[model samples]
Target: MHYAVYFPLVFGAALGLLGPAAATRLPPRPATWLLTVGGLVAAGTTLLVLAILTATLIGGHSLLAGHLHWSPDVFDRSNPVPAVVGAAAALLLAVLAVRTAWAAVRSVVELRQAHRLARTLAPGDGELVVVTEPGPVALAVPGRPGRVVVSAELLRTFDAAERAVVLGHERSHLRHRHHLHHLAARVAAAAVPLLRGLPAATSLATERWADEDSTAQGPRPVVARALFEAAVRTRGAWPRRGACLSVASTDTDVRIRMMLAGPPRRRPLLLLTTVALLTLPVLAGGEALRDAHGLFREAALDAPMHSTPHPTSQR
Candidate 1:
């Protein structure tokens, strides 16, 4: 196979390095979709390349070649993939499969728990549930009818405008289905170790998305102040259970600053370029597959035609 076969793996590592910073810089809504989808695509293409490499190892075996009517000698001579490299690829694929499966299971369990909690909180349509607590707490529970939960203590601390800001932020999470985006990022990270930063980046994007949404009605200062207060009030509060999304769950300081920085500028060029970069892995994978098929076809063509010996007449 051509050296391009390995490009997807290297590209994933490069994406991991750049993705987080890009997630913060871009507009939050687009950034959320880009990071989540990009991670999944990158992980998938990397797996494809690994599978191709693994196949080269097994397909090059003499016994397997005979069954497939392929010439092992020609295959070995033409194969660019080394035996050790193929072995390593196989091992990596197995490890990724186990990790991805475990991550997916955990995500599903957490989401189900969140849904149950939401159902318990509001049996009917979505509504706000205020719980009396010593400290501050707020979270959005996703379900058929999502519920927004807030602590009475936190409500008392916020003025009318800030209160609206907090509610709006959490509501945005439910409306946008941000939890699913997070789950996708989590599984992608598990499948591709190089993309370990993707989940955190997705978290930042979702939080920023909520923050931006909160500013729709009120001034930017109101949203910024509300976020700052939520972070301070819930500084030591225990995290919400399952996949319940909270207004102050991640990068509170950065989000507050971003809110104060004004709306993000529309940079179509950067967004388009990033999207184009995401497709490179998929293209590379296709190229690798084509090259591998050609290699095997050539081997099959070179296989010696053997005439079956006529069976002796039965006595």
Candidate 2:
């Protein structure tokens, strides 16, 4: 295989290293998009390289080559990947597939439960659903129309403007389908060990995106205050599961500071770098595919020569 196949691993590590900081510091919408896209590209490229390595190794074997009409001698002579490396790649790919499948299934089940809850909260009602509970709980439940569920007690605590901030934040989550962004990051992270931090970074970015959206309904300080209060109220609350959107899902301290800091500057350079990172792996994967094709073509061309018996052997 070509050396280019390994480039994605290095790029993935670099992206993982930069992901958290970029998710936190960049503009919320762009940051969410950058991290989500970066995670998918990195994870997908890693899988592609693994598949290529495994295929090359299998194709080089005599038994498989005979069935496939290729010359094992030619393929083995041309194959640059070590047997041990190929074996390890195959194992890793299998394990990642199992784990990713489990994660995806669990996420889907939880999302369905949230949708069910959304329907039960207020059937035939409009977009908003206010339920009475002792403690404060606010979340955006994704459904056909998307429902914003908030505890009645929570609403009573806020004045009209503060209420607007809370409603606006949750609405932003529904409006942009922020849960899907979080879901994609989560599934990708499950496959790539280097990307373990990616899900948290994505969650943080989504939260910030909602916070910024709330600014349209009220002042930044008001938005910050409302979120801070929600965090305090839900300090010891149970953690949210799946793609559910919550006001206090991430760190309130960082969000409060962000709101007080005014609007995030749009970083064109940072965006360009993110785009480049995503593009490089795809291009590298294409090159690796071309190399693999060449290896197989060369093996096929040598097959007939290998199969023909020498006159000396025929006697």
Candidate 3:
């Protein structure tokens, strides 16, 4: 087979390098979707490439034995994939599968734990929780009925308008199910290390999504001020357990600038560019598989056919 079989690996590397930059340029909602979808595609293509490679090895061995009547030595010499390489690929695939499973299970367990804690704290009221604590804390806890937990310090730190902004931001997190997006990104990254950029990028996008939602609810300045004060108060403090989404979690400067700049305008060109970048990998992978299949067929056809002597006596 030709090097087309390696296209998926190359495409994955390109995504690892460039996906984050593309994600950052788009508006928050689209950017979030881009990260989630791109991450999934990248990881899935990597697995597909590995599967193709494994199939090539098996098909080559079978063709040489059945069609060409070739010895193991001849088969090994003719095949593009060496024994060591095929074995290594198989081993790597096993490792990735195990890791992906572990990550998925761990994520589910943690999410359940977070939900249980949230229920224990505020079983009566599913919407909001006001904790009496000296340090500032604000977070959206995802559960059966998601809750926005804010510390008394945080409540005292902001006026009614600022409180509205804070609540609005956390509510957006719950409404949009930002935690699931984050979990999906994490699972994809775990499956393929090349997709590691996605989880962080998605986190930023979700935070920005909430920031924009808060801005929509009230004055931009008030939302920005609320974010700034929350960050200042929570600086260096440990984030609360079950805090999947929080006002103070992301980069304060970037979030503040985004709010002050007003809502993001739709950028058709940038969106199209991101879509193209993500689509390229799938196209390349499909083409590679096609080429690899063609090569395998050609190899099979070219194999020497041994014909048995006909029954001359019977004729």
- Cα lDDT computed for each candidate against the true fold: 0.88, 0.86, 0.77
RMSD of each: 2.2, 3.8, 4.5
lDDT of 1 by residue, 136-252 (tens): 888888988888888898999889999999999989999999999999999999989989999999999999999999998599987898888887787656447658888767899
Which should have the higher TM-score, number 1 or number 3? Answer: 1
Residues 104-214 of candidate 3 have per-residue lDDT tens digits of 897898799778877887887858988886688888888878888888888887889988888899999999999888888888888888878877778888888988898
Best by TM-score: 2
Clashing pairs in 3: none
TM of each candidate vs. truth: 0.93, 0.94, 0.82
Q: After superposing candidate 1 on the true structure, give the runs of residues whose Cα lies further than 4 Å from its correct spot.
A: 236-239, 306-315
**Cα distance off (Å), candidate 1, residue 94:** 1.4
Candidate order by lDDT, decreasing, is 1, 2, 3
Cα miss at 1, model 2 (Å)? Answer: 3.2
**Candidate 1 global TM-score:** 0.93
lDDT by residue for model 2 (1-315), tens: 668999888877887899999977799999999899988898888888888888877988888888888899899999899988889989999988787788788778887877877777788999998777668878888977789878888888999998898899999999999988988887888778888899999999999999999999888888889889987875544336566788888878998998999999988997887787789999999888889899999999889644577889986
On TM-score, the stronger of 2 and 3 is 2
Residue range with the least summed lDDT across 10 consecutive positions in model 3: 67-76
Reference-based lDDT, residue 150, model 2? 83
Clash count for each candidate, listed in order shown: 0, 0, 0
Question: TM-score of model 2 relative to the true fold?
Answer: 0.94
